[model samples]
Target: MAPTGIVLLDTYLPTSDEIAAILPELIGDMFEPPDGIAHLEQLRLTAMGRYFRMFGDWNPNPVSAPKLFVRPGDPLREHHREVAWRAGWPLPHHSADVGGNHFTMMSEGAATTAEAISRWIDALRH
Candidate 1:
């Protein structure tokens, strides 16, 4: 929460430009489909829009439902873990990290992620 006690808002970040600019530097650790650069470019505005425009007055601080924060295990995304831990979700909040970059985690690491989910589900059930 911000000083106003509303949901914390980011006025400065969520720039796709910065991520696009740094892709080459992080190439070794990324997985890409055909025409990845073009795909990124095609998605720049829409991707940035979620933060750049749409989230002006949103509140997610009191997320009531159980939270399952499955984070992408990209080195660049390590902050996700810190954020999740800091968010301090409800008692049964669960989290895990599967290998791969954010997008790649959907493909290359999907099985691992799925297994993590299944385990979490089983744990909850038990």
Candidate 2:
């Protein structure tokens, strides 16, 4: 289904280096490749390079869809909250505190995140 709303979870809008740093941790012993870890590393670097190059200089474009910024209760919450406010998303911009750090928000905080999403979607439906 097409997305009715957008939920950003502990998102940093990471730079190439930041994205690159997570590659090893994320891909460790996960996949087998002919070229080994070098392949994954190259892929990560290339993809992040292109992604940052394309969107790095860009700002949020105006859209009609609703946007929800979900920030964990962490040091970066205020930073992301500010970013969401300044993002100039659609008129019905919203924010929610999922009550965990970035990683935990995805794991331990999944239920809260899901509930927030459900509530947002229900509101949109109405």
Best by TM-score: 2
Question: In model 2, where is the ten-residue run with the lowest total lDDT?
Answer: 82-91
**Candidate 2 residue-wise lDDT, 82-102, digit = tens:** 333222222356887776655
The residue ranges of model 1 lying beyond 4 angstroms of the native Cα positions read 1-38, 41-51, 56-59, 76-92
lDDT of 2 at 61: 62
The 0-to-1 C-alpha lDDT of every candidate, in the order given, reads: 0.47, 0.58
Candidate 1 yields a Cα-based lDDT of 0.47
Clashing pairs in 1: none
Clashes (backbone N, CA, C under 3 Å), per candidate, total 0, 0
lDDT of 1 by residue, 10-102 (tens): 112233343444344344333343422224453664665565466444433554544466655553445434332222222344567677655
lDDT of 2 at 91: 38
RMSD of each: 9.3, 8.2
Q: What overall lDDT, based on C-alpha atoms, would model 2 receive against the true structure? A: 0.58
